[model samples]
Target: MYAAVTLFVFMCLTATSHADHHHHPCHSPNMTGFMSVMTLKGEVRAHGAFTYDSMGKKLRFRSNESHPVNTSIGLDVLMFFEEGVFYEIDSKNQSCEKKALQCSIHPMDIPDDAKFHCAMNLGNPSIEGEGFKANVWTGDIPGKKGVYSMSVTMGCLPVSTIYFMDSTTILFSILDIENEIKDPDLLVVPSFCQGQPLEETPEGTVNTFYNEFI
Candidate 1:
């Protein structure tokens, strides 16, 4: 009886450990993906492709942004955290604007303080192999009065994110994520940006890829 009880206890501990491991936060630091932002009213604010290299502390975003008064514009933005600068390039007119990197950089990963909210299936969960499994996490945005939630696949691929800010609700959908950074050159600063004077912008007015989180 004693031996049987000991075996049962060991088995229980092993099962608990396995469950914890399965729910742990996992992410890929270097990846390329498509990202879109929309309002709660379903208006798409911007859609773009982005490449992130956390190890090198750099990111690139090619965005097609819609404006309330002006026509849609395509812009390419490159951010180098190590140099504390960012460049905005207008490809059509060959204009580049350089500015100081004012916003804090948030990594493309699950935050350490994020808590596991639930497990969900992207499609029909009852049907085997029909859809992918993902985990949802929620946490408060640091230094902000907001909550951020994200869903990621079992392989740590981001599916979507939602931000609840003071007066706005934004939804970010991530798709077609490739776990590898195919073009290392995408993070390089363009030659057009060289020797450009840094334009001074008001604080908290700089719109950046990572600014949505903070």
Candidate 2:
């Protein structure tokens, strides 16, 4: 259970980094898409549907995850930045765990300090088919011993992100993104999660993926 919870938090942190540049004309402040995450060492794998609302400071991730010792878990996390809390829900068990947000929530956008790596085509660009032209950015994770590389389309659609931390490598990929969130209540905290006492407060500076980057 501890491992599962840790993975859930890690996944949530990883998903927070998306594509939005103020200088760029195109940006995705609201998006819903499929997300897949995996570790290079094959220690953990998760895939799910996610909704991100940068304007609303909310996020929702419903995922089926497998990790540490081949345990499978189903989790739904709803994050509310304004409330400074997040709820971890187990739909099958009708249980919810409320926890304080360990790190300040920021918009799901590339950090301004991120260095532009290059602009390249993400796929085959042929006469009959034009591939996605994307900009790549790299940055060191603030207050953490890691670095991240992100690729996004010219229109500010997230393509992929790779985080290198210590000796572990994690990859995050998004696909089939819709620029508008379809479900109006997707970010709402479930009734079961209401009035629950905070279960834990994560300690350590390395708990967040984009800590202090803003």
Candidate 3:
């Protein structure tokens, strides 16, 4: 009886440990990231937390030596079905007149009902070691450059985006990617955001925005 009880207790502890390992809301992308950042101008530093997944992206950027001492935040909920083709939820990440007007680098207004934007092969993609990398051009916004990277390691798949800038480098990394995004509400814009149901695919709307420039 004593030996049996001890075995049962050990089994319970092992089960609990396994459950704890997979309990996070999102999966870590791969390897330890946001590790260190290096700039060409001899400035290197670490920043804040960043999270990404099928639902969206959230990042808090800390100012470095080259930048002003301010904490700026950027959150973008995104989805992708094809290569270089994805929908960036717009209500929270809005541009003027549904991207009708030119966007400024200095920040602009967020329309209550902004449609999703399509990001096509803005540029070509390349690979870095076991990861993937690409630099694309987005012409609707003021700046027309962006970067995307991805890697899968030890059952953790992390996808990241680094917006290209002549001045600064910002990275959006998604970690611990498990659990299918079964919640439709997450993909939907809240009523307060004033977004209407999309008529066609979100990718179609983004295509229209780019058609004007193309």
Error of model 1, residue 100, in angstroms: 3.5
**Best of the two (1, 3) by lDDT:** 1
Worst 10 residues of 2 by lDDT: 205-214
Task: Output the number of the lDDT-best candidate.
Answer: 1
lDDT of 1 by residue, 141-191 (tens): 654578777767777777666766786766667767887788988887767
Clashing pairs for predicted structure model 2, backbone only: none
Which number leads on TM-score? 2
Cα deviation of 103, candidate 3, in Å? 13
Which stretches of model 2 miss by more than 4 angstroms? Answer: 1-27, 42-44, 65-72, 104-108, 123-128, 205-214
lDDT of 3 by residue, 1-214 (tens): 2232223323332332322332222233212223223232323333333222322321111222333322222222222222222233334445212122222111011111222122122123354354433211121233354321222223334333233344554433333334343343544434543443333434324332112212
Residue-level error in angstroms, candidate 2, position 6? 24
The residue ranges of model 3 lying beyond 4 angstroms of the native Cα positions read 1-149, 154-156, 159-164, 194-214
Worst 10 residues of 3 by lDDT: 103-112
RMSD vs true structure, all candidates: 10.8, 8.3, 18.9
Q: Could you tell me the lDDT of residue 43 within candidate 1?
A: 63
Clashing residue pairs, backbone N/CA/C < 3 A, model 1: none
Give me candidate 3's TM-score against the actual structure. Answer: 0.29
Displacement of the residue 5 alpha carbon in candidate 3, Å:
45
Give per-residue lDDT, candidate 1, residue 11.
38
